[model samples]
Target: MAAERPVPTHEVTNQVPPVVGRDISTSPALLEGLRREGGGWAEDEVRALALLGNSETWQQAGRLANDHPPVLHTHDRYGNRVDEVEYLPQYHDLMRKAVAHGLHGAPWVDPRPGAHVARAAKVVAWGVADAGHLCPISMTYAVVPALRATPELALQYEPLLTNGVYEPALRAPQDKGGLIAGMSMTEKQGGSDVRANTTVAVPAGDGSHRLTGHKWFTSAPMSDLFLTLAQTDAGLSCFLVPRVLPDGTRNAFFLQRLKDKLGNKSNASGEVEYDGATGWLVGEQGRGVATIIEMVNMTRLDCSLMAAGGMRLNVAHALHHATHRSAFGRRLVDQPAMTNVLADLAVDSEAASAVVMRLAGAVDRAMRGDEAERAFRRVALSVTKYQLCKRLAPHTVEALECLGGNGYVEDSGMPRLYREAPLISIWEGSGNVAALDTLRALGREPAAVEAFLAELELAGGADGRYDDALAVLHKELVDLGDPEDLQFRARRVVERMALLLQGSLLIRHGDHAVADAFVASRLAGDRGRDYGTLPSGIDTRAVLARAAVPE
Candidate 1:
């Protein structure tokens, strides 16, 4: 009998190409989006973003996020309670770079015509590299407006907050050159319902209060300060709690345990216990929701921006893989099915970028006292926040599948992105919360709805599909029924409003091919429920070219 022939293993073919070492900021789609959005950042900001895209920076980001998750130090060697969170040096390095790039509070400090747009652009760039560090960056940015409720508090913290310095010490705010802030609003029981918080704040008679409660999720627990919600005699109120008291003593804040999260491992989020921690009231008692909401709105906008950035990165990775990997007889990118999916993903990324930047512009104009823009933002923020964040998870999963098994591995960075995607939806507010907020805004602020519709009308005749979608949305919005009925259909209504707004923005600012494809696939419902299902007639090549990553 002949010996059985043993076959050698075949070489791994059609494997995904390496996606790191590319300049993310200079990617065609991102730059085009930034240019179209009128991001008025100076040369320094542009250079900073480009630097973050370098190979070394990308390597550092990967290393920190994956191998160096934060560690919690609950007690000292001598049995004293230290409650310090220790981070790998890479995390601190990234934080410093982020602060130096003006990502934390640049818009507020600079206050230019398109200040928020500039800041949003930087954040988009940073998010592609690493997202965990942005937790503190975003919280600090959000805290500025809410702190203004108390002039004295704002005056005391503004310089520290605005300074482009990253001081991570758990010292008194007065002693630090800069400060990063965190938020502790959710309790184990309440979740998004801050009104259900069980924390109590007893007056200290000097405009300060002693807070006693626990936070289920306290992000960046080692930060110098936290903006938290607690119950007062009047009602639930916002308070500014520092890690250290004014007399150079440690506050009564205790770290119970760090949360083992799915992603965002580089940042520490923990369960905290406050044993009469000293806190100062930010605004009038009982106006906690209103005051903290100012911060919440800003954070919600960042959430959308981050999701958009993540989508762009996801598409870039997919495009990179397809461009280099060969399947059957041709490059995967050249295959018709792959091209359709890539183009569809590109359209989604570009539309998200356009809408987010437009929202940033609205925020800038509103800050400058543009009532029309402010009204538009009231409705647009919720709409975009709900839709874009919800799009991240499924979009990322589809993008990841483009690389098949390679993407599922930890080294490819795709899994990290997939883990990070759903967080934006859960962060500022979940989908239902955003949908309800949109409905609430429409009902309470008719002017907001009017301004939103007017903005959509700017591109009314550009695409037939868009026009049809807009007509349906308009009818749904205007021919309103009972509040309960509106609430029941809120998600549908918000989704339509988001699609119309995105379509309008793309028509006005995005490439013609990209805009057309978006209208056809998204607004017209000509495609299936997944990515890469674009129709054949659309300019898929143009969309792919625009989305290609810069080497």
Candidate 2:
């Protein structure tokens, strides 16, 4: 008998290659978006982003997010209440790198044209690596404007806030070289309704107060200080709560428990009880919502920008895997069906990046005292936040599917990206809340709506599909009917508005192939319900090449 051939058991076939160690900042879509929005970044800022992209440390941060989620320590060995949250060494390493790069407070420290845009781009890049640590970073960035309401407080804290150092010690703000801030605005009863908050703050005779309440969601609870909301004699008010008093003693902040969240696991979010926690009122007593709104608006913009960054990374991973993996004797990316899907994803990512960069530019100009830019920002922020954040999950799911079973495994890193995708939409504000905010913007600031529409009109004649979409949006705005009717259609209006804006941005700034594919598929209804359904005529290969990560 012929000798039976020994079966080879070590063969690994059709395995998708790993996607890492590439410069994320040099992504073609990101570079193009930066250039089109405004090429105002200084050489150092650009170099910083490049370094972040190439750093193995930053890459490790991404791994650490899944491998080492934060843990809460509620008590000491002797049964003393500690209320501490412990993170892995990698988390602190990531935080130190982010702080050293000035991702937290550079824009405010060095005020200049396009400063917010520069800072926002850095946040986007950092978010691609690990988003959880950005909670404190973003709060620190947002708190500056709200702190300005009280000059004394601003003077005492602004330097610490912008010091470009990561001091995680629980001590007095004055003693620390740098500080990170968190926020606790929502309780169990009130999620987005700040007025529904019932936390109480009693006067302490001095310029301070003692807070006694339970915050259902205190994000980054270990921060040096927190900006929280509480009811006072006047009304609901914003207060700056310190973890430690000036005497270097811990405040009466008690951690009840930490939330078991779906994603963003690297950060700690806790249910905290303030048993006479010392706090100082910020702004006026009755205007808590108004004061804290400054912080909320900035965070909302970041929600959109970070979502865009996440989407870009998702597409990059999908394309990289597709190009390297093979089936039926051909690379997956070269296959026509896979090519269409990747091209559609690439278009979505590029358009997202473009719109967010434009929004960041608006924020920059608004900060520079441009009233027109401010007006544009008022409406654009909500619209972009609603649109981009909502797009993240669906786009990420589709991208993951491109990798088949490999993407489903934890080792592939696609599962983590998929898990984190929906968080942006829920955070800052959910979809319905954002939609209503857009409606409120239209009603309160007519010029903001006009500014939004005017920007969309800039690219009207460039594409017939975009022009058609714009016309429909205009008609809906004019014929919005009664308040109830408008409320019922708020999401529809916001979705159309976002698509129109993205279409305009692509037409004006993107390459012809990408712009045409976006308009044809999204605005012209030449696509299906799922991704990778773009029409045959679109330049799928060109779009894929433009968004693919470099070797």
Candidate 3:
């Protein structure tokens, strides 16, 4: 080292600076969407969250939490079973921030015009901090609607789930300052088909039921309560299972083992055994799917929001790298090919941001008794969940490639983001499951299809390419007569529907550059399959300007 230092050959150069300090909430696409979707009142609150969410300290917390995954302690030294999950303090910090910002169920409590919209913006804003801890946060937000099926249970636990205080202990629900919730439904035997679940719940003389079954996949195993499913005398039913009973004794919920997963390492998903665990019924005894569908829909919406948010982060990292790093005696951002790729990525990311906030708006209005929005959500959420979640992985891959070898390294942060991108597609439902669900919604409720079409019509006549695409889609729908045929083409139909919806929203609300490029490239088929293939006419500079990294 002394000899090398004597030669004076060491130099550090061309390394891109990490995106830090600046507020990530300043995303033009996300902010425009926040205001457009009825969350304008919470812009200041959203910025306040960004003050910490995007800070250098919290960014380090994200890395540390992921680096040190959660540990499960199945038994104590005294030979007593103590089913507990131990996450790093950094993980809890993220959870605390998320809860304090009303990202969980707090929107349900707030009686404001855009309560859900505000919560959604926080989700997108804070999401850049970390994706793993949000598993429990999302479930906590989702459980409220399903729990409301039983007003007494909702009255008891809703306040705690939405509580801003972050309590990380296992105590009686009433005694805890706040609560997190999870769901246990899928088993090895049945993934999406909860009807095939082998779990059985036997009623005790008391109102609660004793659930005895093995859950193949239980998310956030340490959460205080879970909405699970088991077979009863009547049929499949939903039950609220708590880790600690009302009397303050541990229930029979056991963590068999933590799942060795591909990503979301900071979140503890496990193979849980509900061995005679005490649980209370959630809704009508025989209508388990119907009761839990509300929770499922809420989680579905969060999945899409996370997908959208995740895309924004990937673009941010890639664009930041491009803006700073140099190549072949020039900055990467100035290269025409790199510029095309970055601009294409921004266009797709902006489309996602626009649609997710619109869907969040629909969720807010639907919860507030807007029948039209409810119908639209019944169809739109599923389609969006299918399209956006599926798009994120490939989008992330392209973004990762924009940084070349640097992105491949762990320090670049793109690898973690890339790992997290595919989870949402699998979480609420897999791609096929989501696509089929959209088809089911279209089939069951005529109102759903009508609402979906009415929404697409909002951007009518904005662009000729869009109009032509819409005409082709309409003709295809008219010709789509056979159920078997529709099912066969389900994903394709849904993708087209999603693109058209995105195109329409961009035409009406998104930046002009984004709308024109999206319509031209996506609908008109004037581009290649890979990114950076925009036609010569597209304004790459205008689109990238909206996604530019702040000074």
RMSD of each: 3.1, 2.6, 1.5
TM-score of 1: 0.95
Kindly list the per-residue Cα lDDT of model 3 for residues 464-500, writing each as its tens digit. 8999999888887666679998889999999999999
> lDDT of all the models against the reference?
0.86, 0.85, 0.91
Off by over 4 Å in 3: 1-5
Best by lDDT: 3
The window of 10 residues in a row where model 2 has the poorest summed lDDT is 35-44
- For model 3, where is the 10-residue window of minimal lDDT? 1-10
TM-score of each: 0.95, 0.96, 0.98
**Leading candidate by TM-score:** 3
Clashing residue pairs in candidate 1 are 341-532
lDDT string for model 1 (306-380, tens) is 988888888888988889988889998999989988888889999888888889888888888999999999999
How many clashes in each candidate?
1, 1, 0
Residue-wise C-alpha lDDT for candidate 2, range 1-551, written one tens digit per residue? 99999999898867754565665544555566565556456445654665575467666776876577778888999999888888888788778878887878877877667677777777777666687888888888888889888899999998989888997868778998999988889999988987999899999998789999889988899998888999998999999998888999889999998899888888888999999999999999989999999999988988887788888888888888988898988999999999988999889898888888898888877877889999999999999999999999999999999989989998777888898899889988899999999999888889999999899989978778888888888888887789998999999999989988888887888878999999998888999999989998898877877887767
Give candidate 1 misplaced runs (Cα > 4 Å).
Answer: 1-17, 25-29
lDDT of 2 at 204: 93
